[model samples]
Target chain A: MPDATEGSATRREELLAIAAGLFAEKGFKNTTVRDIADASGILSGSLYHHFDSKESMVDEILRTFQEELFGQYDAILASDAGPLDQLEQAVVVSFEAIDKHRDEVAIFQNEAAHLLTFERFGYLAERNEQSRDVWLTLLRNGIEAGVLRDDLDVELTYRFIRDTVWVAVSWYRPGGRRTHTEIARQYLSILLEGIHCA
Target chain B: MPDATEGSATRREELLAIAAGLFAEKGFKNTTVRDIADASGILSGSLYHHFDSKESMVDEILRTFQEELFGQYDAILASDAGPLDQLEQAVVVSFEAIDKHRDEVAIFQNEAAHLLTFERFGYLAERNEQSRDVWLTLLRNGIEAGVLRDDLDVELTYRFIRDTVWVAVSWYRPGGRRTHTEIARQYLSILLEGIHCA
Candidate 1:
């Protein structure tokens, strides 16, 4: 039997998961505590027992997601791999994040602008900067190593990669016909090699 | 000395331009006729004198933009250029569209889904399909000519191309550092040859 502390922790996770689904389906502004509770089959008071408000719940969701994701990028950058290998790993890990944390990814993509208006969610903007820094660093490393073309514009390339990867969440279904790994491989191939026949 | 009809036509164009800017920035649902009229230095009553409703204004804006854009695409497809040359021209013309009609592009990108719920915007969906057909035909034409890699996944490629080009509008400034032609050249070179040094 689980201890009381462990049991409540699991219950909290379950509640957060339910809340995330609602937040992802409905815009954050449109979702209320009552909506989360109704979907969770619980009373609103019970939800308040766990989270102070919907803001707290979404705050927790986005915070946890960004921490795990940026952590991976940090580790990849620190690794002893070549620049191209590191870049490939970053792309693969991003898709994995999309697959495993579909709701969190969607919420960030759809709701970050509104949330950033409040002081508490300022880190969302920081995360955007951090994301740019990571891509630029990787691209620069490749260019320096002469593995990637020196003429490539890192700024424009960064925007292309950023737009292509994140905007994909709009159409990507978790269980779609093509798996995330396959999509990543396909994208990386196109990025590394031209589409024209050699 | 201009005829009354020509003078009214120019004023109509100016009003629609102001309305498009508001719709793009504030969103279709958030923007009001009072706001557009205020922006135009007129009263809501006078604004309605020009257009029936905000809906009609957006309808005319999008219809005119798509007609001009798709007309260019149709002309490109019907030209005698080689398949590869035709594909490049389409990409160039698309970037040109983003350059010349930035507000309309943003309005279509941000508001298409919301407006689609109204039965009148159904053609936006068809225009999307037509856009896809144009890209696929160009890609297939390249593949059959043995200019592009046969192994390319045309559907996935179409999405990347679509996402990359349209999403650029979010960051593309009309007269910023790079011209749309320069950006188009950079993107096409990357798309055609990949970024890795051979």
Candidate 2:
């Protein structure tokens, strides 16, 4: 209840988390500010005291998640590791994001197109292009280093990897039988070695 | 348009195509019956004379597409080709569906969850389960034939294949730089053999 305190800041983060779950489960357009408030066991007026609108809550949710994610990607790309190692690390980091920030990932996957229409959320489009660049860079680096097949269609390869990895949010449960790391390992296995018996 | 004639049937097919495009682009809920009529250059009443509601158009659209798609899958399964060839053929057929019936595939991908809640669209859920079964059958058969790697996690492998193949519809444009067959061939190479330089 105190303003500018640690407890108040924690409360703000908790509220954003609840809003994200709603935005992910219900389409962002279908989820009203009241729904977020109701899910948080707070009133609309109280929710407004923390966020001016549901738009502000979503903006904060997506931006904060992306900042943390892209930072990790930057570190991986900047690391002294080999290109193949860097690519593996990037895949691991992506699955880790799915595990740690499932709701945020889901919201971004489902609502990005709708949200990107507004001027404020234009960065979402840029983030998409940036993601493409990250994958392309890793693939190209691997090829140049003789780690990946030179005959690869890097563009299509990037699309396949992006679609397979991110779309897992639809079926990947946090507490599923296989851990996210296991899933990533298996995907990497298939990505690196042919599935056929060699 | 003539009633009870070949022209009537052809006209009906034309109307359904227009409705599928709208439902795919604008979303099923966001698109109105009148919008289909407007896009078809006909009055709403004339459109109704051909179809009862937007629901009927979408139902026909999905059912027709699935019938053709599943029929091709059935033929593939029954063919005398080896398990590996069968699996490859299935991938080729799927890309062909995305190329030929892009709107139907997109509509199914985007609207299946919403439409599945309705009583009449229960088949959509069954079709999803059936599609999973088809892939599982193909994969399990491959392993039994000693073609696929035995250590491979078949279930996880199925998901990776399903997610990667169908999601291409989002970016796989018809008559683009790559034909559907070329895309399928390249994907098969990557799926069968890892992208790593050997």
Candidate 3:
């Protein structure tokens, strides 16, 4: 039999997952605690047992997702791999995140701007800066290592990379034609070696 | 002295521009006829002298913008340029649109999905398909011409190009540090040559 504490923890995760889906499908402002509870087949009071409010629910969803994503990024940055390899690994990890956390990625893309206006969601803004820094560090390191072109505009390149990688969440389906690995590999190919044939 | 007819036409254009800005800033559904009239510093009834409803105002704004944009794409497709040049020109024209029609682009990005659900906004769905066909044709042509990699996934490439080009509206500010031309050039360089220094 499952431990009582483990059972409650699993149920909590399940509730958060249901809330994340509702938040992603309906705009965060439009989704209520009742809606999440209904979607989870629980009463609103029961949902309160797991989370106090929708704000806390979304906060946990975003915080947990960003923490895991940033951890992977930090690990890539700290790895002894060459700059180019680190950059490639970063792209791979991003697509993996999209595949695994599609709802979280969508919620971040759609809600972060509005959410950041609130004092509690200030960390979202910091996360944006940290993401930018991660890409810039990779690009700058690549340039210094003489692998990436010196003429590359770090800021624009970062924006391009960021846009291309994350925007995949809009159309990427988990069980769709291509796996996340396939998409990431193709994208890396185009990024590292232009589509122009030699 | 301004002619009455010409004056009304100019006023109509101005109102549409205002509506586009508001719809872009606060989403289409969130904006109301009174809000537009308020922004225009006119009574709601007087605003109705030009547009009967907020729907009409947004319709005019999006219609005019798409007509102008699609006209440019048709011209590009009909031009004597090679496939690669056509692709480059498409990117150039896209950034030009971002520079010239920032608010319209923002409206399309933020509200198109929601707006397309209405029967009146059905054309927006067609416009999306047309845009996809444009890119696919360019990618297919390039691959056939031996200019692009044969192994390229045209669909994914189209998404990448579409995302990278249009997502610029999120960060691109006209009269900012970089000219649209410069940004487009750098982006084209990255797309065509990759960032890797030979």
The top-ranked prediction according to DockQ is 2
Sort by DockQ, best first: 2, 3, 1
TM-score of each: 0.87, 0.92, 0.91
lDDT of 3 by residue, A101-182 (tens): 9999989987787778789999999999999999999999999999999988899999999989998988899999999999
Better of 1 and 3 by DockQ: 3
Worst 10 residues of 2 chain A by lDDT: A1-10
- Tens-place lDDT per residue, model 1, B1-198, is 435457455778888999999887666766789999999999999987888888999999999999999999999999999999999999999999999999999888767755776799999999999999999999999999999988878998989998899888888998799999999999999899999998
Query: Which portions of model 3 show Cα errors greater than 4 Å?
Result: A1-11, A30-34, A42-53, B1-9, B30-34, B43-52
Interface RMSD of each: 1.8, 1.3, 1.5
Candidate 3 displacement at residue B189 in angstroms: 0.4
> What is candidate 1's CAPRI-style docking category based on DockQ?
medium
Task: Give one digit per residue, the lDDT tens place, for model 2 in A1-198.
Answer: 547455545788889988898887766776888888899898888997888888898999999999999999999999999999999999999999999999999888777866787899999999999999999999999999998999978999999999999888878998889999999999999999979988
Clashes of 2: 2
